[model samples]
Target: MKITGDQQLIKKMNKTIVLDTIRQRQPLSRADISAAIGLNKATVSSLVSELIDSHLVTEMGPGESSGGRKPTLLHFNRSAGYAVGIDIRVNDLLAVLVDLEGHVLQEKTVPLADFTPEHVLEQIRKTIRQFSKKLPESPYGIVGIGIGVPGLVDDKSRVVSAPNLDWNQVDLYESLASEFGPNLHIDNEANAGAIGEKLYGAGREAQNLIYLSIGIGIGSGIIVGGELYRGTSNFSGEVGHMTVAENGPLCRCGNRGCWETLASEKALLDRAAKLWSDSHLDLEEIIQLARGGEPRAVQLLDEIGARLGVGLANLVNILNPELIVIGNRLSLAGDLLQDAMLRTIENRSLSYHRKKSGVAFANLGIRSTALGAASMPITMFLSEPDPALAQEGSPSAGL
Candidate 1:
């Protein structure tokens, strides 16, 4: 029978649904998929056949049947494609090569001595090439690349401002697209972290969660209803700039008493510097000191934790998220910060609002942004009806 345009679209969507079902509940038979998604046996078999032909699904040996003949089980082909995720951190870049399932195949950390966009771009290119060299055999080699930038990324994937990187109005998409092709994504690092946590880390079960990236400066990724809440200008979640203190310390953004100025990793370091004018201590050293039961270090971390709780309390009252995940550098001191942070939140936040909220540290450690960034491209690549579109370098697709 000749298929109409709408019929073809429907078929493509069904095929996608079939692939997703297999990915989510693998090692299931066609009858199982049909029953799970309410599709007919014939339609499910047809879509699964197309997926198998496309190298996205593989058939395994028959599974035990209730009384009749055994059924052939299907599995999603995770090794069919690969993606690259990069996190452009303040001091370095964290890059990872991941399979379709978001498992890291290779990981690298490149230090950044120069913050210039040109230099950073070169390092990114070099890192991708290194990853490509070590790539495993796959049908779709390097399906796409996703980058998480430490700045305000506009809807068009332009870096509007990143104070830590000294970047403003940088068009990373344009620069990288030529060599990398069309399947690319650039977003704020915190947004990427939120996605990472939601998909594979602490926020996996929470439909509404906030991922706070507390580092040199505070930033956040707010997930509302299981999706990142990008504001009207795609510049939401700049929680660091929120005014918490009327007469607080000066912030790099030219504001007084912004939340980051009082509660971020920099804030902790600034206070530590003042206490130990004779010695220089990084975050790791300070955390070690606190762990060793040092009075001053413990007190300092407690103070930072309380300050962090102030902002978190505000977030809790406003967003009422199911979970709040603290990530990035400050999260390394989660143990040291938990007591004071929770105490302050208990004291300050609305009792009703804080009751259902649970706070936790990042489960993926520092790789949240990198893995999340990588997942973006993988998602886009998989949503396409034709896998050849990725191979042929077609325009961007979405999940």
Candidate 2:
């Protein structure tokens, strides 16, 4: 149980769950909501009434009757309040604004010449300020801001260890909260990618799913039974550090022979630099070259994909999730890489969980983690208890 210093926070949280559920899955009846959220009938009724009163949810026509009178369908007012997601990458920043139903309303990108936490924060703040100006009129204001970072995140929104950004123990939560005034949330990029995919990507239909973000560094975001599964200390998806090549290349995290050294985006780039270092090319360029019958680039990507599949094979054997989603820069490489990874994984997996699941590309592509950042603020923007839970903010509410 969590003892909060505030009581109003508890009430708002209760209604927030109902509102979020309606927004995520529309046209749900109160009965369906209660069943979906495991809340009792009376609580659902009160929360639904509160949402309708707030103009966040509205009752539609009747739904099919389940013995009793037909229940009224409920839906979120998509125009209620907006959420912004930000993706902080090594080369650029992707910012997207989504409405209540997780629809993208606006998107923008900014270039980054270098990777510095302080500089990125300024750029992020400016981008957020500019993006907020474009939102349509709303009553509740922008609910929150979610940030997808390329490093480890504590529950308090601090960047514990982002090897790519070289940020260690930086309190980004305080920095953003100080400027934005409490509407900031942060998570490892992989976790954000996982949530974006879970809520709106290929894994949306699966309860147990793994989202592998194979970018400059390899990381994973896990979802078990329809919610993010953060392990002790909230850094569950740091699988990139998992050892693959015991004596392989040294990693920025001071580890040797890590899976990241084999399968990370930088790993591919490191191999590519030997082939072409005259110009700084984006990930798309490599994919384009590999696509345009460039055998060397194609071969390089295939090998990288094979190694990534090898790394994931271990995870699949252990997690046995229903779906495996691949995201980030290399995902844009398409089937050329996917085929190699698939072949390798099928060969390595012990046949039982082999065909039990399928690999698919992220619908949101590289922007997924950033779009997930848009979802992050949902927690921060929402200060109240979730209506679906028996107790507000209890671990089970989203654990």
Candidate 3:
């Protein structure tokens, strides 16, 4: 059946187009926006005015004169709003508050010895409050909060299960909403990491990319055609559980030798435990040792990288992504691990697959998850402003 567009919907679509045009081709004039968005000059002017009024866009006086006259140029006001993002893992929480342009305004990492839901939630709330206390004035203040959980998250952002953390049926989003308000989002840590890399890190230019979050456990986030592909059950990229060794040690998920059990940070630490009984030697220390030419450290990292490459080869053979970004704590291993990973990929994957996919370490480093999480709010504000915020008398009602 055919349907007609509502006047409001048409207006919103036009506004989005105009805003996107300005964002993509900034320092543009009315004529430029009109031509780029295919909107009439008058309509473009009205939308630009609305955007300016919303503090989402700004006028930069004038641009280089055409044959006729100089025109006022427009710029996207990235600092007009703010967002909060957090990455919750089994052992720690990383949180950041960022402006609309993806610059971190504030950040903190808290180690966790307790994995209880209440304890985790309290830590998150505390961090958010600390961030809120320092929020600078903006059109939108903490517009939304996005959290990345290292687990199976449903479409509604509920944690179905996180075997590593032993969490099941946890309503993280709902639990935080009462204190943080309605504008909260949650997703799998890998999925968040993928978008993080795509938006701000190594995968920025890659439309089809895979982000492998190799922390305590490995999780993947698939980006297809510049969009995240959340499967029917939102469990599409749980590649950690993909069995690689039939007789290998049993995984937390009851699987035998899942890829993560062999390649993840936990795996490295486990192997290192045999040589160095010091519990204080972190992944970073191990990587430093490997880089320093320590024989045992180098050998352990090679094994980890090879296992990681095996799983990556499986992904490359099937998906053929343009890039595969390895992030999370294990990424700290740097070239010491990546060289071995590339060698294994070259040996294990088909020539076609090996040549097509480029493996890279995450450029965003540890901030990937927090930045990506914060982007959710920035995205929502830019793409769809809250009606309440736009209403009269709201703090963010006017630019």
Candidate 4:
């Protein structure tokens, strides 16, 4: 019997669903998946068989059975392929090679002395080559690459603007697609961080959450109903540009009173510079000083935390997210900033809103963006009906 297009599509989708189920609840019998997803045992078995043929799922020894013969358990083949995730920061680029399960196999931090697009692109290419050289043997080596840019990435994966990197209208997808195949994703760094936290970190259990990347600038990734909510122009979470203080300091965006100018790590360093003119104290040094009970450093953190809280309270009042994850460089100062930040939120946000909202630092530390970025290509590759198509530009394919 010839299958129609609709039937083929449905079969492909069902196969994908089965693979996802196995990945999420691995080491489970085929019967468990059929029961869990309400599919018939025959259909589940067929899909699982297809997944196994595609090398995306594997079968283990028989498991204990409630009745009759024991059932063999199925597991997602995490080592079937690999992906590269890159997070472009103002001063450095963080790259990670991760398995299909988002497990980091290798990681590298490349310092960026130049913010020019050409230079950064070269660095990215070099890093990917290095990762390819060190990759472990797998069926689909280096399936694809995902990049988190510290700027506005359009729907077409174009870097519309990255103030920190001095980039505008940079088409990274076009630059890398020739060598990496079509499965490339470029998104705002904060958006990537939000996804990272949602899938594997602090926001895992919360459907609605916000990931705030507070480093040189404060950016946010808003997850509504477990999905990133990109605005009309794919520039939804520019919270740093929100005006908090009417006559506050100037921002790199040529705006006064922007939230980042007062709440971001840059803001903290700026204030610290004024207080300790003789010492060039970075965020780490200031945090260390605060930890050692330095009165001035403590006060400086308190002020920055209060400012951060002001913006956070506004976010809570407006979005009412279940959780707020603070990430990036500023999160390293979480210990010193918690009290004053919470206090400001308590005084500012609506009581009802604050009650349901919990604020926490990123559980993945500074690797949130990198891991999240890596997951994108893996997701795209796994979603393909034919796994071979996903391996077109992989290193194992001689690309």
Judging by lDDT against the true structure, name the best candidate: 1
Task: Flag clash pairs in model 3.
Answer: none
Per-model lDDT: 0.92, 0.80, 0.84, 0.92
Q: In model 4, how large is the Cα lDDT of residue 93?
A: 96
User: What TM-score do all the candidates reach, one by one?
Assistant: 0.97, 0.84, 0.94, 0.98
Write the residue-wise lDDT of candidate 4 on 50-152 in tens digits: 8888888999889998988999999888999899999999999999999998989899999999989989999999999999898898878898889999999
Q: Higher TM-score: candidate 1 or 2?
A: 1
Tens digit per residue, CA lDDT, model 1, 267-309: 9999999999999999999999989999999999999999999
In the order shown, the candidates' Cα RMSDs to the true structure are 2.5, 5.6, 2.8, 1.3
2 versus 3: better TM-score goes to: 3
lDDT of 4 at 147: 97
Which residue pairs clash within candidate 2? Answer: 13-384, 13-385, 13-386, 14-385, 84-374, 85-374
Which residue pairs show collisions in model 4?
A: none
* Candidate number with the higher TM-score (2 or 4): 4
